[model samples]
Target: MKPFKACSCRDPETKKLLGKQCPNISKKGHGGWYARYEAPKSADGKRRQPRIGPFDTERECKAELARVLGTAAQPKAHDERKTTFGEYLERRYAWRRSEAETGEGLKKSTLDAEREAIDLYGKPGLGHIKVVDLTDEHFRELYAAMRKLNRPDEKDDRSEILRRLKEARATRDGRRLHSRPISEGRIRRVHAVLHGALTDAVKLSKIRPDNPTDGVWRSKGGKRKQGRAKPLLWTSERVEAWEKTGTVPAKVMVWTSEQTGAFLDFAEATEERLYPAFHLDAYYGPRRGELVGAEEKDLSLERKRLHILQAQSDDELDDTKTEAGYRQIPLDDESVRVLRAWHKQKLRERLQWGETYRDAGRVFCYEDGSALKAEYLSSRFRILLDRYANIRAKAAEGWPADRIARKFRTTEAAVAAALQRPLPPIRFHDLRHGAATMLLAAGVPIKFVSEILGHASVAFTMDVYAVVADEMAEDATRRIAAFIPRQNRLSAVGASTVPSGG
Candidate 1:
């Protein structure tokens, strides 16, 4: 293709064409110079002319003409159907949803998370860019934008702050309200969604063969350096601090052994219907979802084993988080007893409700037999812990009988008796961590802990519970030293110097 030419309008008064012959054009100065080019035909084979600019000089117009011609000469293969990144993401999500419905793709929870990431980060940051035009620089810009969103500056806009405050008041319960920065883990999840979408685009030939995200730097050099915070054990010091400040360290907080026992005891005493579920979680480290998803048919009371074939997400039972999460977990005698008691309790409820009872076959359920919502259980667990804390505080202060009784909704005698003990508060999922730590501390093999926890691999288990493992290693060192008798060591050294039997 030849470079397009530039021309300028004539002087209005003179009414003469200001072509190359104009005296002003020789001086390289002109007014209203415009570049015109014969543009490429449309896909429908219609001819068209495209104009670029109204530069004051012929040289400037010519440069613009050259750039436009160059761009037109190398048309994008998929330019016929230009798709924005946002549009592609929507299409990709629909395809994924279709595959999930057909049992060929992501789990509902996984898909929901991806959709959230796309809407919150992907669409807002890089959505307008064409998939074929996405570059490493664009991804870098996207990451920078995401980091800004992660820890957005306190909203300076009064209207926005008022809106958020209104929302807070609407949802406010006794729970404290605070803004939390989007964690590194959440940013990584968003990146994963973007990477997955780009990968799919490449496979479908919607974009270039290479995925731009493949080479993009993660928010903090990948999740290994800035991933989810590890679960923190509720040691005595942490418990004391928490009791004083009411601030729990790390979201995933594990209870100490004493606290775990105290929670189990309190749950049982309070007639919590899901005590058995909590019991299993504390002893076996099954996820909250797995505990809620437990079915009576999958339990072998005689064998003391529970099959973790699935997990509860929202109100629906679905496949376990991974294939490895489908393994069987052995139950202790106490766990078996608790489950047996819960089973008998369930049967009696079923009998009482009779025809009205909804038999979902879940090992844990409401008295009416409907499936338990995972969110309800989590919230209820927190509420129960709060109640337990209040009761303990009242008892500690030596409150009079009637006040304690009225506060706890129990007899004064019961309140007085319960005052002798107190339990530290912890999140429900922390029960799983407590179980893993207890097992590891008690000299259970890491492999067994891994299998019991349904972790994908022992390495993952080790990584998560490395603190406990280090403690166990120190204990082992001391025990080994104790086992090697001083006399025996001395005898061996003397024997070595004395020479062989020959």
Candidate 2:
């Protein structure tokens, strides 16, 4: 390692840096002193020469070089100084992927989201900084910068995204990437991932002496923060408003019992192959990943149970997100009947296809026995909703049966027979929410509902479905009032009704 003097002067013709060739390099204030040292070998065994510098004085540069040389005995200490945050993040994700093969790491869906957090936010903001250079102030500034950003949109053009962020940062006025500002909750989650990574750097890898994020305050102030939005049911009023405005009442919405039944009935009437999967979701509340990844062997008709052993994320099979997610859900008689019929249909199709069939042992699949994609559930659900909405509109308009059939390009009988019950729009995941709401409405214990939905805990389930719980409580109050034999119920307790001592 050696300390050297360098200047920012560049060659006029070549447009290259003139390091030691500058005429004024010997002058005291003409150039800055720099330190050059060989870094530890990379994973591929390649040596890297990292230059540290631009110190105003030669003494300072030599001191930095001496410090760097003293740490040569410990390669990790050198790494801590040279490794950028982005580099470490990439390594961590790679490690996680390797560990996942042993069934003890994050699923693809989780890793993808985390990678986005790192790339979209982390890289642009703090990625270039060395791990050792990170501080509470750095993180605080990062949080402030994140709060100023608009929500990212995959569909937005790259130039548009750049312009959006730049304008948002410069003038605090710009077209949004989506409908609203990036939520504080999202920032908090980003902070959490970063904090975890830094903590690992300090404790697990021993790359850093301490985590800089430890001293960083996550939020600005106050005890209040936006929690997860509870699912709201699609009541008649809400449905009307949605039809008029094309917006949901909440981020998460559930269907009323009538709406849920209408959707399922319409699906079955149309001979949708995934009807059984939809039924399972509506009644049992398994996630979309779980529904598609379900194996035929995991179902037990005699035992009336379905085991959630794994899930498909990004079209790849992986373990469930949590231990609670890997559970055995009891099936109702109706579910069993639906599964039996579905099994028979699948068998018939398999026999027809013969050697061409692709049997992956999935309980729900295409006619050729190919596995269903996780996203198909959501997209197909949307298609079904639109079809159902169109049919209902035609029926409501009192169009002649033949005209309505011709409009839909289907038989007049099929068009006329379509159920007209309103199927208010809800996400496929909302089918899971509707299932939980139905369970709560049916007076099933909250604990049982939690287990059915594969929630981490009853409290979490209750917290998420608190709206449904409140509605159920109100209904219970009304039912109890009606059930009790009250003779001329008083609007308020009379003074005479109170005890004499009171």
Candidate 3:
């Protein structure tokens, strides 16, 4: 390492020499101190003198020179291995965010999800582990820690409910009032994020060539598993239990054909502006974001065709979730009629709002013509379901259907039909599931359903809705059996010919 030296210049005010015989000082530029050193040789076998900086004083320059030389003296493997997992994750997030902003990277929604996973699971669990030291075991431990981290405990204070109550009293803003345990799906997401970051690290040569997260176990052995739970259809028994206990089975639930029709009848009869959107989801299986992101120009009501070009991702409108998501769907006569009615309704609302209306060109919008938010749509759908349930309960108690219909501003027929079958509690996304199930039940080809649903492949569709496929198989067997005759006419014809028996 080079020794410290001061610049050889006289102080302007004092008119005196700044230093005496400073050998390491450079007379170039502004006569500031600098350090000269030898860098590692290339494959051709030649040395080069690398210069440091125009530091204020020789002491500062010398300190920097020492650090540079010390780093060079270490093995090449250790030179690029200084960053920890936490630090690399932050850098990776920044890079990904920049890519998303420039429109050449991951979608904003994807980046946000990655950021969340890093903050919630990555940083808290494996932040301190150095990139060089990261191993499959580290990721395994991280999964275990995340699983145990936010588990609800009996002794924990349920302060969120109290906070929500206070907020309700002070202001009528409704937010979630409680927390739930971190799901296996979320943990798997974190694992995916970590795996991606470390894979990049390997490519950048910041860590070992092999990725540590490649085959890490997400759960303990022997039946403990990690992945998204398959969606469960709400049966009659489940609906009854839900009515009594106010609890629904499975995070993702699908309604039967009758229940779906009931919901649609209620929405349409009540003149819900979003009825068209919900109807499209049930019949065509477009994602919630896609339905909200739809625009007037993308629809061809006369031709009975609708184009899906984009989807809402948080506050930004972005490309579809996957390349396959950008597709054209053939609309049935009913879908076209509903869409045309909705278009006319939107025009009326726009005229009422006049110059104050914000025409963002979205098919679904608020009364003010502003774009509809996905979360708002979901929340409103839940409210409508609750109202539907109440109306059904009243109808069960012998309340006059016409009176109930008048009270709710819907038709008496709609009320009667909605009460005919028990409504299954389902989320907004479940409408997509119901659509797929209905199509499969009707014997639509799985490939066609995959395309309509914008799934990457038919195998994926079959995997997700395996239960539906099983039921379809049984139906196919029964239909085949119905075509076969127990008595053979061919045998009787052959028996009449005596030569045939010989």
Candidate 4:
């Protein structure tokens, strides 16, 4: 029998073979083995090539054609200079992220609004304009479109596609509407990010002349400014609640922070049996990578010290966050106990996994005998929080469910949000303050507290946790308790005697 073969099909129109049309192919082989595609041209005659692939059989030809019909597509290379402003913004936006992981050029998150502005206004208004020809007016149109993320009328999802078809959109951060019709504050963050990217691009001379984001502060109506960032420092009530419940996922984090003694100052913590790993972070603030990177071999048991011997990311091993992240942290007897436990747990896991595991010489591992990603743990922490709070605080705090669904990797969004929770009216770091208060009440010297908390100077230690309102209230009660006058003092010409300071 002959090898299987199929004949070509032809279009009824003028009997031209359907396969030979220049719908977009750059070149087609005479032997029927290959086809090269050029970009499609807009009405203005500027063309861009987006899709290119090689098929082993004709069965794939129709499938490739179907993919091109559906919406949501990237601009072809040929349309590089003629695509919408939104196209440029999206491309640059992705570029920055890819660069950041590699430790390459300027990296940031300010492209969100720039991207939205382009999607919302810039591309419609001036995307067709040559990249070399962008100007202040184009920026204004882009800004105008971005304003919609905040505004309701501008938010009509139905007109989303139509509204984006302008050659007059612009983006700006202050009170001005990005594209008018936009009216909300929740989206200001995206705008802020976008503007930052445009500004940096301007500095790099990637885009010509001035940046459209110049002078733009993330704001709405030049007034309703974006909220300030605040750290989500755990509080005593919250901590005590966790200790009592002992079921919250964040409990480990809180316990770990307190137990680390790297930062905790509660006198009871000095009981000498508990590990105080928290002090290490309180003093050093090791990024998750640096902290999780610690391993058994990195410790000197006799000296009671932990060293940052190795660190890594999905990409490759790196020195700590900076040269300074590489340091030897002295441990106390208590801290040693905790670390030793964690070390034993890890060693057991490694041995169980044996040669089947992806080895990274890490100190932190999962109960499953595998390396635990820091991000995954963060997610678990949130879950444990939700369950512990009976789902009350989670909803009240407005965490993203979709986000929490994934494991904790140290994403900027998670980190920023984790750091953005509101602080108490007094010292926001009251957990630290409470710890210090406990330490001071037990007569731990200010100098020792300073060393444990990792403050380079003693004055800082004294200034922060020494003046608690509750402590003052206690002192008031003690001072008001006065005894009967001293008989000897009366003989000395005093009817009543009190301490000189009193």
- Best-performing candidate as measured by lDDT: 2
Model 2: residues >4 Å from true position, as ranges?
Answer: 1-75, 119-121, 135-189, 215-224, 396-398, 409-419, 469-502
Per-residue lDDT of candidate 1, residues 64-174 (tens digit): 666455445433423522688889899989998999999999888898888777766677667777776677887776565444431444243333323333243233574
lDDT of 4 by residue, 140-220 (tens): 554555554445655464343335543234345434334445444434544555555456544542443346556654355
Clashes of each: 0, 0, 0, 58
Clashing pairs in 2: none
TM-score versus the correct structure, for each prediction = 0.73, 0.72, 0.69, 0.45
RMSD of each: 7.6, 8.0, 11.8, 17.9
Looking at model 2, residue 453 earns an lDDT score of: 87
Question: Relative to the unseen true structure, what is the C-alpha lDDT of residue 79 in candidate 3, on a scale of 0 to 100?
Answer: 44
What order do you get sorting by TM-score, best first? 1, 2, 3, 4
Q: In model 3, what lDDT does residue 189 have?
A: 79
Per-residue lDDT of 89-203 in model 3, one digit per residue for the tens?
9998998888877889988888888987776567656777777667787777556554543355423534433222223223235432224555666767778899999888767
What would the TM-score be for candidate 2 when compared with the true structure? 0.72
The candidate scoring highest on TM-score is: 1
Compared with the true structure, model 1 gives a TM-score of 0.73
lDDT, ranked from best to worst: 2, 3, 1, 4
